[model samples]
Target: GESVGLHLPTLSVQEGDNSIINCAYSNSASDYFIWYKQESGKGPQFIIDIRSNMDKRQGQRVTVLLNKTVKHLSLQIAATQPGDSAVYFCAAEGNGGADGLTFGKGTHLIIQP
Candidate 1:
Protein backbone atom coordinates (compact mmCIF):
# COMPACT_ATOMS: atom_id res chain seq x y z
CA GLY A 1 0.00 0.00 0.00
CA GLU A 2 1.17 3.51 0.80
CA SER A 3 4.74 3.50 2.08
CA VAL A 4 8.04 5.29 1.94
CA GLY A 5 11.28 3.72 0.71
CA LEU A 6 14.84 4.52 -0.17
CA HIS A 7 16.66 3.93 -3.42
CA LEU A 8 19.68 2.62 -1.58
CA PRO A 9 20.04 0.83 1.71
CA THR A 10 23.60 2.01 2.28
CA LEU A 11 25.52 5.06 1.13
CA SER A 12 29.23 5.59 1.52
CA VAL A 13 30.81 9.02 1.36
CA GLN A 14 34.36 10.15 1.83
CA GLU A 15 35.22 12.53 4.59
CA GLY A 16 34.77 16.16 3.56
CA ASP A 17 32.59 15.17 0.64
CA ASN A 18 28.95 15.95 0.24
CA SER A 19 26.29 13.25 0.64
CA ILE A 20 22.89 12.83 -0.85
CA ILE A 21 20.17 10.50 0.43
CA ASN A 22 17.06 9.80 -1.61
CA CYS A 23 13.60 8.54 -0.76
CA ALA A 24 10.28 7.84 -2.49
CA TYR A 25 6.80 7.81 -1.08
CA SER A 26 3.78 6.12 -2.53
CA ASN A 27 1.26 8.41 -0.96
CA SER A 28 0.45 11.33 -3.17
CA ALA A 29 -1.62 13.03 -0.52
CA SER A 30 1.31 13.38 1.81
CA ASP A 31 1.73 17.04 2.63
CA TYR A 32 4.70 17.13 4.96
CA PHE A 33 8.09 15.48 4.90
CA ILE A 34 10.83 15.00 7.46
CA TRP A 35 14.37 13.70 7.43
CA TYR A 36 15.83 12.04 10.50
CA LYS A 37 19.21 10.79 11.60
CA GLN A 38 19.65 7.96 14.05
CA GLU A 39 22.95 7.10 15.62
CA SER A 40 23.84 3.74 17.03
CA GLY A 41 21.46 2.76 19.81
CA LYS A 42 19.64 6.04 19.61
CA GLY A 43 16.30 7.25 18.38
CA PRO A 44 15.95 9.15 15.15
CA GLN A 45 16.85 12.81 15.45
CA PHE A 46 15.18 15.43 13.31
CA ILE A 47 17.52 16.75 10.69
CA ILE A 48 15.43 18.79 8.29
CA ASP A 49 11.94 19.14 6.88
CA ILE A 50 10.02 20.51 3.89
CA ARG A 51 6.40 21.10 3.17
CA SER A 52 4.59 20.08 0.01
CA ASN A 53 3.88 23.69 -0.82
CA MET A 54 7.60 24.32 -0.95
CA ASP A 55 10.28 22.52 -2.90
CA LYS A 56 13.31 23.01 -0.68
CA ARG A 57 14.36 23.87 2.84
CA GLN A 58 17.77 24.22 4.42
CA GLY A 59 19.14 23.67 7.88
CA GLN A 60 22.51 24.30 9.50
CA ARG A 61 24.37 21.68 7.48
CA VAL A 62 21.63 19.93 5.64
CA THR A 63 19.06 20.57 2.93
CA VAL A 64 15.80 18.78 2.17
CA LEU A 65 14.16 18.79 -1.24
CA LEU A 66 10.65 17.73 -2.07
CA ASN A 67 9.29 16.76 -5.49
CA LYS A 68 5.58 16.48 -5.08
CA THR A 69 4.89 15.60 -8.69
CA VAL A 70 7.13 12.56 -8.54
CA LYS A 71 6.66 11.85 -4.86
CA HIS A 72 10.37 11.94 -4.31
CA LEU A 73 12.46 13.50 -1.55
CA SER A 74 16.12 13.93 -0.87
CA LEU A 75 18.49 15.11 1.84
CA GLN A 76 21.84 16.66 1.20
CA ILE A 77 24.60 16.81 3.76
CA ALA A 78 27.55 19.12 3.51
CA ALA A 79 31.08 18.09 4.43
CA THR A 80 30.61 14.52 5.43
CA GLN A 81 32.24 13.73 8.77
CA PRO A 82 32.72 10.75 11.05
CA GLY A 83 30.07 12.09 13.33
CA ASP A 84 27.65 12.07 10.41
CA SER A 85 27.69 8.28 10.18
CA ALA A 86 24.20 7.18 10.95
CA VAL A 87 21.01 5.72 9.55
CA TYR A 88 18.91 8.34 7.90
CA PHE A 89 15.18 7.98 7.39
CA CYS A 90 12.55 9.95 5.54
CA ALA A 91 9.03 10.21 6.83
CA ALA A 92 5.75 11.51 5.45
CA GLU A 93 2.75 12.91 7.27
CA GLY A 94 -0.59 12.72 5.55
CA ASN A 95 -4.32 12.77 6.25
CA GLY A 96 -4.27 16.33 7.38
CA GLY A 97 -1.44 15.57 9.85
CA ALA A 98 -3.72 13.54 12.07
CA ASP A 99 -2.38 10.09 11.31
CA GLY A 100 1.25 10.89 12.06
CA LEU A 101 4.17 9.88 9.87
CA THR A 102 5.11 6.86 7.83
CA PHE A 103 8.85 6.22 7.78
CA GLY A 104 11.03 4.64 5.18
CA LYS A 105 13.38 1.68 5.54
CA GLY A 106 16.28 4.08 6.13
CA THR A 107 19.70 4.50 4.55
CA HIS A 108 22.90 3.78 6.43
CA LEU A 109 25.26 6.66 5.79
CA ILE A 110 28.85 5.53 6.12
CA ILE A 111 31.53 8.18 6.36
CA GLN A 112 34.78 6.87 4.97
CA PRO A 113 38.17 8.36 5.44
Candidate 2:
Protein backbone atom coordinates (compact mmCIF):
# COMPACT_ATOMS: atom_id res chain seq x y z
CA GLY A 1 0.00 0.00 0.00
CA GLU A 2 1.15 3.53 -0.85
CA SER A 3 1.54 6.16 1.82
CA VAL A 4 -1.12 8.81 2.17
CA GLY A 5 -0.27 12.31 3.23
CA LEU A 6 0.75 15.63 1.67
CA HIS A 7 2.91 13.58 -0.69
CA LEU A 8 0.66 11.00 -2.47
CA PRO A 9 -2.66 12.31 -3.76
CA THR A 10 -3.88 10.34 -6.77
CA LEU A 11 -3.83 7.14 -8.83
CA SER A 12 -4.70 6.36 -12.47
CA VAL A 13 -5.69 3.04 -14.01
CA GLN A 14 -6.68 1.49 -17.30
CA GLU A 15 -10.07 0.02 -18.08
CA GLY A 16 -10.98 -3.72 -18.23
CA ASP A 17 -8.18 -4.59 -15.87
CA ASN A 18 -7.67 -5.19 -12.20
CA SER A 19 -6.91 -2.06 -10.19
CA ILE A 20 -5.17 -2.01 -6.86
CA ILE A 21 -5.44 1.30 -5.04
CA ASN A 22 -2.97 1.57 -2.23
CA CYS A 23 -3.32 3.57 0.95
CA ALA A 24 -1.27 4.21 4.06
CA TYR A 25 -3.18 4.89 7.21
CA SER A 26 -2.07 7.53 9.69
CA ASN A 27 -2.86 5.88 13.00
CA SER A 28 -2.08 2.33 13.97
CA ALA A 29 -4.29 2.78 16.99
CA SER A 30 -7.31 3.54 14.87
CA ASP A 31 -9.99 0.94 15.25
CA TYR A 32 -11.93 1.08 11.98
CA PHE A 33 -11.18 1.84 8.35
CA ILE A 34 -13.32 2.45 5.33
CA TRP A 35 -12.89 2.91 1.57
CA TYR A 36 -15.00 5.18 -0.54
CA LYS A 37 -15.41 5.86 -4.24
CA GLN A 38 -16.45 9.30 -5.40
CA GLU A 39 -17.64 9.73 -8.95
CA SER A 40 -17.67 13.00 -10.79
CA GLY A 41 -20.10 15.49 -9.24
CA LYS A 42 -21.35 12.93 -6.76
CA GLY A 43 -20.78 12.23 -3.08
CA PRO A 44 -18.40 9.69 -1.74
CA GLN A 45 -19.84 6.18 -1.94
CA PHE A 46 -18.91 3.48 0.53
CA ILE A 47 -16.97 0.59 -0.95
CA ILE A 48 -15.89 -1.58 1.97
CA ASP A 49 -14.54 -1.45 5.50
CA ILE A 50 -12.26 -3.35 7.82
CA ARG A 51 -11.37 -3.34 11.47
CA SER A 52 -7.86 -2.90 12.75
CA ASN A 53 -8.16 -6.39 14.17
CA MET A 54 -8.81 -7.95 10.78
CA ASP A 55 -6.21 -8.59 8.12
CA LYS A 56 -8.50 -8.74 5.10
CA ARG A 57 -12.08 -8.27 3.95
CA GLN A 58 -13.76 -9.09 0.65
CA GLY A 59 -16.77 -7.73 -1.19
CA GLN A 60 -18.38 -8.09 -4.57
CA ARG A 61 -15.33 -7.95 -6.85
CA VAL A 62 -13.47 -5.92 -4.24
CA THR A 63 -11.13 -6.66 -1.39
CA VAL A 64 -9.58 -4.64 1.40
CA LEU A 65 -6.35 -5.83 2.93
CA LEU A 66 -4.86 -4.43 6.09
CA ASN A 67 -1.39 -4.70 7.50
CA LYS A 68 -1.08 -3.44 11.04
CA THR A 69 2.68 -3.81 11.12
CA VAL A 70 3.39 -1.20 8.46
CA LYS A 71 0.06 0.53 8.95
CA HIS A 72 -0.87 0.05 5.34
CA LEU A 73 -4.10 -0.80 3.50
CA SER A 74 -5.05 -1.53 -0.08
CA LEU A 75 -8.22 -1.87 -2.12
CA GLN A 76 -8.39 -4.41 -4.91
CA ILE A 77 -10.94 -4.00 -7.69
CA ALA A 78 -11.46 -6.93 -9.97
CA ALA A 79 -12.09 -6.45 -13.67
CA THR A 80 -12.36 -2.73 -13.19
CA GLN A 81 -14.68 -1.16 -15.71
CA PRO A 82 -15.42 2.37 -16.88
CA GLY A 83 -18.09 2.60 -14.22
CA ASP A 84 -15.39 1.91 -11.66
CA SER A 85 -13.52 5.00 -12.76
CA ALA A 86 -13.61 7.49 -9.94
CA VAL A 87 -11.68 8.98 -7.04
CA TYR A 88 -10.78 6.31 -4.53
CA PHE A 89 -9.70 7.10 -1.02
CA CYS A 90 -9.44 5.61 2.44
CA ALA A 91 -10.60 6.78 5.85
CA ALA A 92 -9.41 5.93 9.32
CA GLU A 93 -11.25 6.74 12.47
CA GLY A 94 -9.54 9.04 14.89
CA ASN A 95 -7.77 7.25 17.71
CA GLY A 96 -9.85 8.74 20.47
CA GLY A 97 -10.75 12.39 20.14
CA ALA A 98 -13.27 12.46 17.33
CA ASP A 99 -15.58 9.84 15.85
CA GLY A 100 -14.98 11.15 12.35
CA LEU A 101 -12.71 9.54 9.81
CA THR A 102 -9.54 11.09 8.45
CA PHE A 103 -9.68 10.73 4.68
CA GLY A 104 -6.80 10.35 2.31
CA LYS A 105 -6.55 12.31 -0.94
CA GLY A 106 -8.76 11.34 -3.81
CA THR A 107 -7.07 8.94 -6.20
CA HIS A 108 -8.59 9.77 -9.54
CA LEU A 109 -8.97 6.47 -11.43
CA ILE A 110 -9.18 7.16 -15.14
CA ILE A 111 -10.52 4.53 -17.50
CA GLN A 112 -8.15 4.58 -20.41
CA PRO A 113 -9.56 3.08 -23.53
State each model's CA lDDT, in order: 0.94, 0.80
TM-score of 1: 0.96
- Model 2 TM-score is 0.87
Winning model by lDDT: 1
Task: List runs of model 2 lying over 4 Å from the truth.
Answer: 1-8
lDDT at residue 48 of model 2 (Cα atoms):
99
Cα lDDT of model 1 by residue, 1-113, tens digit: 46999999999999999999999999898989999999989999989889899999999889999988899999999999999999999999999877889999999999999
2-68: candidate 2 lDDT, tens digit per residue: 2344234565667778888888866667778889999889999999999888999999999999998
For model 1, what is the alpha-carbon lDDT of residue 84?
A: 98
TM-score of each: 0.96, 0.87
